[model samples]
Target: MLSDLVDLVLPATCALCHRPGGALCAGCRADVTACLHPSPRPAVPSPPPPGMPSCWVTGEASGALRAVVTAYKDEDRRDLAPQLGRWLAPALRAAVGQDGSARRALHGRGLLVVPVPGSPRARRRRGDVPLLAVVSEAAGGLGGRAVVATVLASTRVTRDQSGLDARARAANLHGAMTVRERQERAVSGAVCVVVDDLVTTGATLAEAARALHAAGAAQVLGAAIGATRRRVLVPANSPGPAG
Candidate 1:
């Protein structure tokens, strides 16, 4: 309520187009939504990271879409979480569909949506793991069918992933995450989909999958709002955005 009051008084402009309204105005929102893949499909990063699970993304990481995500993640635009979470829903739906447990879990079992753990350094600088907030919103939009459960945590500090190649990222994140011991019971039989704001190199998701599986996750999949298209050679028939 207080934030809304502030927004009404200040009238912030769109982060990308800078139109006076919100962090992402309707016009710019439409353009970013246009970039969404229409339907989620497998998104495989170049030289795919080891143990990478099936991943789906809403759009390629670039243009207005990337700007929105970057603003939400790095520019302290926490207000964009709802819009970005809405964008993530499609990919999350696809991921849930792929996980047999999720479909059935809606009946009686529970589906846990987990976000990739960011390093403590990043969290301290960013004020929060923005993805977790986004994932919680996305799960709420899924009705009572799913719930957000942040069971994973960084096991040790690691170097910043920015500018790291696929190999370097894989090495840096290797065993960097683990399911908290106390939370093992919650994850043991849960159908989980590891989520991130964007997929680059697929290293983080792969490492996340490793940790989830280590804790006895019934099934593990990945979904992201966007992915980098750099050198990710998708086959002609693959229904995903690539250039």
Candidate 2:
């Protein structure tokens, strides 16, 4: 078949390292998993504006994690979604306490994984939303029991969040997203996990959460492929980088 011929010729090179057999080579896959693992201090949720929901950061946002997330998100390298989702799965599993006996204790709880819908502009540029791909792959890895929902939509087009501080970002997205009337039933009574490709100022995720909550989602928790950590920059003449 033509598909088989293409596979034979290209051999599916790894997205991270270009290894000619797997989606991600073993070394790069290990690095991705290590970068996304839960940190000692779980990110706390920031209070968002009305109609917006709160979001928590699970892992520290260092240069390494940010680089991987940015590469996939901004550069349109969607082939990395599966590998990124694989890295994200373990931390998400841990956040919900899926190891050992806890897994059964949480079974059938009806957790819905809803990706934060991207703008039409972004989709047009990228050809697809990265979070959807990540969430879909993650759902498959989770064995298909948990529901992966895309019940929210962007009702208004908004400016890109790049170059905006937290406050500006929040303002830009205010009143920009909404849950469609038909999809309300899907979110109601479900513990919604809002997934995104990255969280910089947390504005987008917060808005997405708010939309879901307004639609009657029981509880909304935030998850992402990565987040931005506060970095202390050392000036050239600064003493010991300031305590």
Among the numbered candidates, top lDDT falls to: 1
Tell me how many residue pairs clash in candidate 2: 1
Model 2 gets an lDDT of 0.65
- Stretches > 4 Å off in candidate 1: 1-5, 126-128, 230-243
Q: Can you give the TM-score per candidate against the true fold?
A: 0.88, 0.74
* TM-score of model 2 (CA atoms): 0.74
The local distance difference test score of each candidate is 0.84, 0.65
For residue 200, model 1's alpha carbon misses the true position, in angstroms, by: 1.1
Worst 10 residues of 2 by lDDT: 97-106
Model 2 lDDT, residue 130, Cα:
47
Write one digit per residue (lDDT tens) for candidate 2, span 1-243.
Answer: 575687667766765566775656677666665665445233443433343333434455665566667667776656677777765665455444523322432366666778887777767766535478878777565553567777877887888778877788888987778887888887777777777766666788778877887788777766665666644455667677364
Error of 2 at 8 (Å): 4.6
Candidate 2 residue-wise lDDT at 230? 49
lDDT of 1 by residue, 145-165 (tens): 686877888988899899888
| Clashes (N, CA, C under 3 Å) per candidate | 0, 1
Q: Residue 126 of model 2: what lDDT?
A: 63
